[model samples]
Target: MQQHNDTIDSAASADEPDQIHEPRLWRDKGWTARVIKNEDGEGWAVEMIRDGSAEPALVGPWTMGRNKVDPKPLDATAHQTLVKTASEVIRRHEQQLHAQLNKEVSIDFGDDVVSVRLTITPDEFEPFGTLIALNPLGDVLATTNVRPDFRLTRESAGRWAADGFGKIR
Candidate 1:
């Protein structure tokens, strides 16, 4: 096996069309795994970056070779594991963001149950939220715009319903 360094050679350029499989680098299945020296410690670390992304989605300590000096070589099994772990990290981040931007609640208004949903649109200048009320059958009852910081709770939703779904003050 050839000794490898952290930097990618010309043949393994990210822009190249062909996939690369090297001792320290593996680029395939839309992901690239690179073994690099750990800046914070004496050992080595591996980072998995998705294609077209500017940063690595996952980075962790790498195993040492039998010599206990050089880093272990990248192999098919290790590459697949790294890809799977990185993909999961991306998926979890997306789910957490979605939950933060969307909220929902159900409340009893008069003789019917109403479902209230608040969806927030984040912007650099002005962030806003939309509050929508739906009847038990999922028919739209009312819709209005509100500030992104608006808190949607059982008490607030009840008050909004009692006020005939007028503009929130």
Candidate 2:
């Protein structure tokens, strides 16, 4: 039933304070688990927030206590499970973002297979993309800047190579 008001101000450092283990809050291993009142309904909810992150990585309903009026106290097993799940959520998000920003395709051009890759850079004012073509031996044949919204597909890559790797229109 200890109390702690530690705020997530920055990434976990080597000199950070010792770990905290409370009934409703637990902080350790670069993650914090907090059981709070559920805003959507009557039951409680638990949130897992990683250090230095402004938002919770995962939030879900918490089990009710024996009396059915209070929330079950946070424990080590529960905290570990929450940490694993929240870490997975963050990992999936990163993978999805990477997939969205990068695309690749291989197509038969002339007598050889050419690998084409498009990487998008999301900038606030001037988002752009790079289109690269490589020979079967992984030698770069051409590279050019293109609109960020450019879509790289088998057909488009074939057309680009068929056009002699010129500017995409």
Candidate 3:
């Protein structure tokens, strides 16, 4: 839960000064932490993300962060590990998308062709909107959506156009 930019002790109810043994890498405005009280009045470790991004940033099996054996709250070590893991996860996702775009899927829209060439775009959110399509001779024929019509064959540009490829959005 987002408790306004703070990572609280999962096992401790009161904010008894966070025995900060080490510094955290993700100490940003978008990150937070909270202590989750379990049914047995136990505490569970959980992180919060209020950046309004795709996923909620949470940490731990919650109560598992606390040792049934130790009952200690989350620490610097665990938080650092969490940061690394989350960063790697997002990096892998972008890498996979780059691989997909660069893999080159040829679209046969009759005389027209579409190629999903990978472009080094600015580091930003997920890329969307229509991208241009160029031919082997570098000629512009039609502007289709990022996705091609699966039914359109290279030999059927006229048909694809008639069915609506270059129609102005």
Each candidate's clash count:
0, 0, 10
RMSD, candidate 3, Å = 11.0
What tens-digit string does per-residue lDDT give for candidate 1 at 1-169?
A: 2435435454465567658889999998899999999989899999999999999999999999999999999998999999999999999999999999999999999899999999999988999999999999999999999999999998989899999999997
Q: Which has the higher TM-score value, candidate number 2 or candidate number 3?
A: 2
Candidate 3: tens digits of C-alpha lDDT, residues 1-169: 6764345544342443323332222333234444445445555545544345655445454544333643345565555566666566667877886754443335665575555332333335644334345566767545544432222333343444456455423
Q: What C-alpha RMSD separates each model from the true structure?
A: 6.4, 6.2, 11.0
Residues forming the 10-long window of minimal summed lDDT in candidate 2: 1-10
Best by lDDT: 1
TM-score on alpha carbons, each prediction: 0.87, 0.87, 0.42
Compared with the true structure, all predictions reach lDDT values of 0.93, 0.91, 0.47
Write model 2 residue lDDT over 49-145, tens digit each, in one string: 9999999999999999999999999998999999999999999999999999999999988798889999999999999999999999999999989
Flag clash pairs in model 3.
6-33, 44-63, 45-62, 108-153, 108-154, 110-153, 110-154, 110-155, 110-156, 110-157
User: How close to the true structure is residue 24 of candidate 3, measured as C-alpha lDDT?
Assistant: 23
TM-score for candidate 1, residues paired by index: 0.87
Off by over 4 Å in 2: 1-18
- In order of lDDT, best first, we have 1, 2, 3
Candidate 3 or 1, higher TM-score: 1
